[model samples]
Target chain A: MNILAQLPVIPIILPLVTAPLAMLMPSEKMGGRAPFVFATFVVWAVFAACAGLLHSVATTGPISYHLGDWAPPIGIEYRIDLANALVLTLVSGIAALVFPFSYESIRSEIDRRQISYFYAALLICMTGLLGVTITGDAFNVFVFLEISSLSTYALVAMGADKDRRALTASFNYLVMGTIGATFFVIGLGLLYQATGTLNMADLKIQLAGDKNRMVEAGFAFIVVGMGLKAAMFPMHLWMPNAYAYAPSAVSAFIAATSTKVAVYVIIRFIYTVIGADFSFAPAAFAWLIAPLAIAGMFFASGVAIFQDDVKRMLAYSSVGQIGYMLFGVSFGTEPGLAASLVHLFNHGLMKGALFMAAACVMLRVGSHNCSAYAGLARRMPFTAGAFIVSGLSLIGVPLTVGFISKWQLLAAAFDSGRAWAGFLIVASSFLAVIYVGRVIELMVLKPAPADAPEIKEAPLSMLVPMLILVAANVYFGLHTELTVDLSERAAHALMGAGR
Target chain B: MDILNFFAERYNYWIFITLMMMGLYIVISRGNLIKKLIGLNVFQTSVFIYYISIGKIAGGTAPIYVAGDMESRAHGGGHGAENGGGHSAPGADGADALPGKDALGAGALHADDMPHGDFELAGNDLATLTGNAQGAHAPALHAAPDAGAPIAGAPDSSGANDILAAPALKIEEHAIAAADAVKEVAHQAGDVVYSNPLPHVLILTAIVVGIATTAVGLALVVRIREAYGTIEEDELESADNVAEFGAARAQEAVA
Candidate 1:
């Protein structure tokens, strides 16, 4: 029971504590492997904790632990409500699965000298993500947000050995990320000025009077700041390059966690901190947020259609996926919040599977371009199978996790008296099919190039992680009670608070 | 002609109409994203100013606590009695009794007084005890101007019972009348518009948003420079065009 109570902080702090320990390892050859193994075990522990936290939150309601026993409104609190607990589980589980594969993958892609530092940075990045999800304090969220972001920049920049452009991508991400963090800070400052509180629960009580201008300003700042981080539409320019240019392992880790964490933060602010009633009824924030979501879906997907690189296309797909999550939120209802939460989990699985498969292909073919993947089904059937299954989920095929989210989102839009929004949600699924279909066709149907060398299945280390995520995509798709029920409860909490 | 004259007589409408138009124009015409942000700031600020202006009493400050003050008295004056009582009692008679009284005192009195005492006392006895009930139930009886003269001029009379009733009734009527007069004066003294916090909130949010956006824009510019060796948007476009041309030429050469 005591260990369970301490689980939320452990998920974030373990990686941070291990980062320096990873650096203290004897040498890159023998001792370097120690960090990779240790990180893998730590990530597994975090995954277990996330699962326990999720179960606890779903059954027993929100789990809030004050840091150092200082209660909220004064002390920083770590809150594992249903919404964030579910995301925490997804993120930690993916990192756990991905790190084992990173051992072999890193050996091939990154230099031997960089391996120890890479593991150190990877652990720190994990800490940032889990911390961002678990903390209840608004400013604490920013601190974790920057920690994760700075590590991500370092991880992305480490790709300079393979492609010099990775430096530029990392630099761009750094700038955009800094701006996003600054915006977040300014928003928090405004909220603090208006309400004189940093704890989300306390801020809610302080902001109920509708007489504070500073608080309202704070809400806008927080939303836009988070939107930029989540790659919301026009704000998403940094993502594709960053995702495409980074090393395959780095790309997979980030694709699975970073933006999804950002989306979680946005949802946390909209539903838990700001309350849905303000977003939906009186202010009509849905009217503002929905259009941007819809625009991102079509605009990013359309731009993705022309990309030659499969990774870049999936990167654009991430922007569109973020749009779906945003669309669910814009409904500002229980079903809407549920859809967003479920999609947050589903998209992570689909993207993790897809990017890992891309990494596998990159490992074999040494390129992520569509031309390089020609007739990969004939050569590497397992990787191709993983891609197809995850791709179907991405396209929201019936009986998949994506379908469940889209269906709920459509229902939410209709419930909100905006049936057109439902139509748009359905229409955007077709755009997904178009982009996902392009990659599948090239990988499965097209004949292999004559000059191309013979390719084999991705090694057990890589294939196992891809298969696990793909399997999760299907498992969650069929038995969605856990994900959907928790999301519904979270949405209820949000809507009830607003009213 | 009459409608136009009525509108012309109300100068507040004219100012509202003019400020609203100017606010709309600034939001529309700005070029720089930051300037547009500022325009948005002004546009939202004007709306806040308007809402505050509309809600203003003749004397009111921003609804913020002043330093060195134990309590905030910003939202005082008009509608004071109703607000002072913390919106519990719905009847106008209760509101009238506490007209123009400081909210803290009246709030405590109403919270303690009405719910316990009013239900305990019945019909005519309740009406006679609380002057508000007598004034409200029989406005015409209380309105008799001669009632005041008897209270001031006569010590003994055939209508001594009526005379005793007169002073209580007159005082209740005067308080109600005073409340109405303050309300009328507040309506006329609409120049001191109550500060609407909504626009200030919106503007502050916009400024933060603007700074964030500028940072993002500058970041994108730096990224473009690094990627294409130029910060200019047009140069980046040309660089992309050239990259596309090179790729197409390579494909043609392979064919």
Candidate 2:
């Protein structure tokens, strides 16, 4: 009974346990069907646990479980406060919904040999993400980060069977990702040596009077390292190719979770690890992160406008979305943190649905290019409807999750005494509308190719997940109390930690 | 002299600074990805050295384990040696004395006995002995009293000593106390100092991510190679553009 008190470990452990079990399943006939079902169940269980854990944390303060019963400052601990628990729920919930959709999607897109391995990699990636969100120990975060990253690479590589360019895209990602992870580790190592303790809470207590120059150097390394991972503007070179060329399932999953997790880590570092009072405050943040974020928002959107491939365009749009998140965090205020968290959740839903819709299109039309989607609304009405709704959310239309996030971020920027930041946010939304509108126009108004093959609606399995996310976009848009309140609490905790 | 003082005063800082610059240079200048990672490592390691150096106490040993094993044995050995020496010292002092010396003569012959009245006068002549004995006990008593009196008088006599020693003792004690306090603070602060572990962790993850990304990239490159028959980036771009051009031309033909 006492051992069972550690239920929080289940979210990460379930997926890890299932990943190997997936590989061990016998015969392709059984292996193919069984792993996907098993993975779906495991992901659901994780989502359920994460939701319960999030509720528990919100009601009863943070939950901290030390692995091996070894107290903190020695052994690793999994700490789920309001902020991360909420993120954990968001990520795991998305996975739960996405996995069922993946079954039908994977059947058509991926080969037989890769299906079991695909589920295994997906599970491993889930474990990494869950581990990242739950662990209180700083180094544990890194370890889990690698676990997720390695699996993500394998998943991205799976796309090569479809498009040969997936190989080049994966390779480019590998190069950039290695640099980012290396930078992250160096920063963590420096912090460890400086403080002699890897426990975050203990480190916080110890760092109060530490005004050394080395600490400042560590701060710089961490920000840059995480910035690269989160795909903040100039460091986002690897994102477009990786997202565009990967398999539809891989693209949807990575698009929804990978950069969001990176953003979580960055927020954890900036607000919790290095208290906001540190000398590298407003000036450094404004000077470094803000310009790049603004640049990314405008430039990526502009670039996205020219992409012939729908998936690639969305990939570039993702870069621009990341820019908004960075912009929110750059404000360095409670409202700003709240805005970032909101956008983090909102963007996940929007991108997940958008990518899933693209997968549906690919399933029917055999390509994700804009030309292929011409008159798609007539042939595949539901998939096209899903696309339009998700696209509207991406453009921050009212009564959608995207609008909630953008509204909060604009309000945050205004609250931070930068009223013009609101204008910039709106302008970026306008840019998004332009890119997204172009695709909508091509899908609804343009004539289908005279020689085009007859297109059928995507299978129910794929549409279920896409619709769920689109529904969530609308549901959360109108009733944002749960998401917004959770974000607010997270913001408070972050602000308190920063001080 | 300037160079000597500079080295003597800030040698640790100099070492860290040099290493930091070297690491930074490697990270920035190198073209190969792995080499850049190694450079990142060197830069981070230098920061580690800096933090560790600052936390060191001037005379303290590294926090290693040794005292637990030796403590009991050393205590037992010290007790045995002290007891043996206390008993044997009396005999050794007497054996090394001149021949014919009695216990009283031996007692008087010791180096520490001069402060008390002399006992050798009793052995010389009866008349001198009687005269010396009359005041000898008195002098012995008075000698003990004088020694006792100085104990009380010592405080007054060393008033000037107290004045001289007071500030120095205070200074030394304060310095030691401050060092100890700083050490405690540093020990606690040790956990929180931003060591930039992120960079180290990020580097490894980035390497794996890089490799994975590279594999994916190469796989894409291979696909591009198959589609266009070249691994070159420029060629792939041209081919993709050509494909787009073909698609546009096909649209034109239909129109």
Candidate 3:
């Protein structure tokens, strides 16, 4: 047996094992950095495993890893194709990069005794996301989604030492996220009742006929449930507070991966499992997602410009960016789905960098308020520089990752003959400019308070990850072939129009 | 009768929806943190009920095994005598009643009755035939209508066989054939053939997920109570707003 055939499961199993081990390892005697260092190594190992899995998938077609040697319908299967492999890589890759940065941020934000627990939760969260991406079973999706969400709630609550509001923020997220997960379970249950199978492939084959009410209801429930998790449009009430109040590392990690993973689940269900030819396809994209995405793009960006806290501002801006990704999906064309996939990957890079920058600032400034950014450019030039690069990327400035995604998305709209969508895509970037501009103005132009303490540059540990992420934003922007090609393959896989 | 059939076929689904709605209503309407989590559990359990309900077969029992013929052969002379006695039960008698009859006898109830509503065979026929518990009625069973009059209200033939096999094992062990018992088990297995096992497996995973969510949710609530001095959702919001305004004032001062 080729040992490498089992590579797809390693990413999930690594973290699953590491998380409990991290919890068992004492944090006090080894210093707060022990769990951090171990987790960083474990996450990087998961990233390497994902990279190996992706490499094998690219070469040998899809790899199906059956748990306990049972076949697909009888046992849990981990199927890795180009689409989910790319997502797996993104989640593990981002977790690996963010964990190193989390050390100092968690130290500053979380309680001394709870730091090891925080690392454990973060590792479990990563494992959950990886599992969600890799599993071939429909119910496993719900299971992994909850696993990640539950850990994420705890991770967010770890910020209670920094701000008491983190408590309420985590609670709200728990309520909303649990509801979403339950809705997802109900949807999966309905599908299981209708089709009598839990394997995603088996579900697809069983649901091939004209829309049955149970299947349609299952579809609607799943979309709405995943939308809530993705923070899609009006369902995004839980996101701002959760992102804004969480420990900066938690914010950086979750803001980058959690909702993106949710969006991936939506795409997987809509395009792959249910098939794009389902009767509800047009109405779902047109009447539901299309208009909502447009509304979100405008509504969230408008709300974002008025936010006082820079982290909350970015959180709202993240919601609007999600609108852009959904708008790409709404077109229901190959280019549209490709654009959505591209933006999904590109946006992760940009958001990770931006949130890391915010964390770097929070490290020195002791606050997330935009007012605290006064003369930050002069105070911490490197971090301020990283923030500007990522902020500009968020605004879709030329030669940045955000611009590449926006360009592809607009091109998709144009090719699909939706001139209004193209126009709106461009117009929304103007709103991005306004919100991002406000942060830049505060950092660069506002006078420093005379009573403000001398704030040193963020520790090298934090800066290295932020700078690497910022570099990725610029590097991936200039060299678009890697992300673009992978996304096209993923989109084609979704469309079922190509091998 | 039509309404009863509809309710019989669909009552599980109705209960599922009702429980689902009650759970969702509880989650949405409750303000207390613990209540909301309880509501979530109820909502999730309703789904579990829905999944488990889908796997039910009208006359089927739990997905398990009953002894087959090969195993009966291993039982030697007792197995052969049991086989001889069992197949001689009413409606099951034929020249080759020992082996093939058991296979055909269980299905003989409904399969032979092609007419939709006209067929009428009393439930007591099966009771007396399989059990021979009413030793007094053994003559009546032998004198009863031949294969002409079908067994009415047998509902499911496999279910009838299940009822046939259990008591016959003790009271009239030799009356029913060993192969018939296997046939009874096989018939029961056939009704179960269409019942899905995938949902049950998935629900096992889902239950674990539910417990995990409950644990983490309660942990978060405990932390929230520690920080805000309240587990009430409404009270927590006011505390959050107070902090929000404080930050806003701080911003205004800098500006």
Give the proportion of true interface contacts each model preserves, from 0 to 1. 0.00, 0.23, 0.55
Q: Per-residue lDDT of A1-499 in model 3, one digit per residue for the tens?
A: 7867667778888889889888877777766777888999999988999988888877777888888665665457998888888888889888988999888887777888987898899999999998899999887888788889988988888878888888778878987887888788778777765655577876677677646787888888999999999999999999999999899988899988999999999999988788888888888999999999999999999999999999999999989989999999999998999899889988899899889989988889988888888899999999989989999999888899988999899899999999999999989899999999988998899878999999899999989988998999999899998888888877887798311
Residues A1-499, candidate 1, lDDT per residue (tens digit)?
5776686688877888988887666447683688788778888887887888888888888888878765565557998887788889888988988899787777777777878788888888899899999998887887778778877877887676776566557755765665566567657756654554567886776666445455667777787888888889889988998999888888998998889999888877776677665533335455667788889988998888889989999999999889988888776677777788888888998899999999998898888888888899998999999999999999889877878888878888888898898888888888888888988898888999988887778899898888988889899899988888888887777667666
lDDT of each: 0.68, 0.71, 0.76
lDDT per residue for candidate 1 within B84-117, as digits (tens), equals 3322232334444544434443222121112111
List model 2 lDDT by residue over A174-252, tens digit each.
6566557656765766676566556777667667766776677777877787777788888888888888878897899
Runs in model 3 lying further than 4 Å from the true structure: A497-499, B1-9, B68-185, B188-195, B246-255
Here, model 3's chain A TM-score works out at 0.98
Chain A TM-scores of each predicted structure, in the order given, are 0.97, 0.98, 0.98
For candidate 1, give the lDDT: 0.68
* Stretches of candidate 1 exceeding 4 Å from the true structure: A279-284, B1-255
Q: What's the TM-score of each model vs. the native?
A: 0.69, 0.74, 0.83
Q: In terms of TM-score, which candidate is strongest? A: 3
True A-B contacts kept by model 2: 0.23
Alpha-carbon error at A149 in model 1, in Å?
0.3
- The lDDT, on a scale of 0 to 1, for candidate 3 is 0.76
Best by DockQ: 3
Q: Decide which is better by TM-score, 2 or 3.
A: 3
